[model samples]
Target: MPAASTGRRIRIRMSARAIDEPHRVASQLELLFDLTFVVAIAAVTAQFAHDSAEGHGLAGLVPFLQVFFAIWWAWMNFTWFASAYDTDDVVYRLLTMVQMGGVLVLAAGVPAAADHSDYRAVTFGYLIMRIGLVAQWLRAGADDAASRRTALRYAAGITFVQAGWVLRLVVSETGALPPSAQVPFFAALYVLELAVPRWAERTRPTNWHPHHIAERYGLFTIILLGESVLATSRGVEGVLGAAGAGSPLVVIAVSGLVLLFALWWLYFLAPAGDGLSDRRHRSYLWGYGHYGIFAALAALGAGLEVAVEQTGHDIDASPLAICYAVAIPVGVFLMLVWMVNASLLAKPVMRPAVILGCVTVILLLPLAAPQLGVAAVVAAIAASCVLLVILTIAPWTRRLQDGCPKP
Candidate 1:
């Protein structure tokens, strides 16, 4: 039966029930939804790079992490929820548009958020997204009888956490809380937000398609990596306009591209979609843990931008700063990817300790000689990229040597 019987069309179409399709690829609406995130990611990264270029050094990272976590968490909530219940009808599309608007508001606030002050726009944007999410959960409850209770719990939990966010915003605006109090307050709220879905899932698990969720994550990762590529190009362009494609700038640009490519290859070496399907119980670990991975990748782009600044005649880029900007994110990304791979497999597929040892060697080279130039430091990291490729190839090489059928 139709959800409404009156002559006038119902605004709530009673669409967006659980999906039943197999072999699902992301729909056009999903891709369009991701475009908003691209804007958010670009804004956040631009802020980080600009700050680092202004010599804020590591002092800028905490604020970046906080803002990034909020942005990433909002995106994750929608991704998982949509994986299970995106009906793509009129109501669903409109709510998603509202969420997209929320993303733009959030992006607009990123620069101020990075300073850990001026958070009204950011908080309001986040509240809009949370309300949009609650609507989806409530719709789910109305649409699916079997999962109504679970959906209601989700709606309740999210609504409850959103109240905490609202409180934080009010306290920040009204001076009810000191600036120092803001960190702990927001941290507590973040913890509560993270715990909600876990709490809701305990009552009854929602039907999140592992494969679809994995693809969505992968797509987001690609967007971040693309941001890295863009940053690299922008940095190179800045240097090229001033330095005229000089040797150091050219080397730095090429090495940065190589590093970005290597990270891309490393990320796709394992079939994340298949792994998620195999170990559904570990989905939370796989899903939540990716926040770090995504953040690191995006930051690495900004780091490359910092390296570009080093090529300027006026900027005196510290060797340590340049090295840290690029190397730390690369190290963190490699480590997290290793952990994800290890956790996903029942047996050890590759020796993670060996990879760690190699990464450590790569990271330490820059530290060993703090006087090293930016291009040389970038080249060292680029050399590490070769090691990763070798590691990826070794397993296939051994299999062929042993006369095993090619996978």
Candidate 2:
């Protein structure tokens, strides 16, 4: 009886061990968090749509950039923190729930906040979310020295940046200075925000999980992809309902879908996660480089939404909007591809391809604008994807043949 009892205890211990370290989030949890971001993406998309529909032009672009940057920065910070110290403890779970609530609050205020004469409430809600993020970092710092150092550095940098953001909000709202003067001031502060972290990381580094970080980034990409699909669906449904023309809408939707799929394929085809996983310690560039990619992904979705709205309408869309949809994603995709290759191949063979791709796409734009409309521009985007696939696979295939490890 004593021996049997001891064996039962051992089994229970093993089961507890298994339960403690989850390699990935459960499907339900992923779905839940994803749903919250769905709300966020929808909110941002609505703001963009509203501005475009009103033909606000450059007036809308500035505020969209501001709000988009804030939202993206918040999401990026949370994802990195979770990647590092996601204990999956009950406390951690509860905190995440609070953060999610904060995201929803922030999302709800996005439109009003974008054009608000008094930006204090908007800044305050953002500040609250940042506080929650800072709390998470503080907790991590207290528990693990390495994580603590990283978290503290991150928290400090974020605090400094948020302070600047809040100050800008106050200045803008108070009418103490003209709005034009605020641009350069804000630009300088933005540069500082971008640079300070790089400096800090170089001077005082922290240990971050490579595979987990890679997966977290991949998850965010999936989130943006979800947004793209949503945008495409919204466009298709509206067109079919209004015009009752299924064929054109279907072609447009398929083009968007295919472009997204190709982007996904191109991203995974080169073994980015595995490359980063191998060199997780030296992955700061790979990690930081992804911010551009994330922005591009979100912008792509926004642009697609714009395209959908303008479809079959005689109203001429701005060159800026059309170029933005095609250009931003291509630029981001190229940069991401370059960064991944630099990380894995440990050299810069992808630069020429990126430059060539960019130049080609830019030259194609005017020709495409008059001749192609949204669908043709999308087709142009598809062509760019094809070029990228060729660029990516060519060298990778050569490397394999030369007896190099598959990157």
Give lDDT tens digits, candidate 2, residues 102-210.
6787777777855663456556767877887877767766766544555578678878988988788777777876967866876777677666556556644544455
Among the numbered candidates, top lDDT falls to: 1
lDDT of 1 by residue, 159-219 (tens): 9988888888887789899988978997898889889888888877878877788788889
Quote the positional error of residue 315 for candidate 2 in Å.
3.5
Compared with the true structure, all predictions reach lDDT values of 0.81, 0.64
After aligning candidate 2 to the native by TM-score, how far in Å is the CA of 362 from where it should be?
5.4
- Tell me how candidate 1 scores on lDDT: 0.81
Clash count for each candidate, listed in order shown: 0, 1
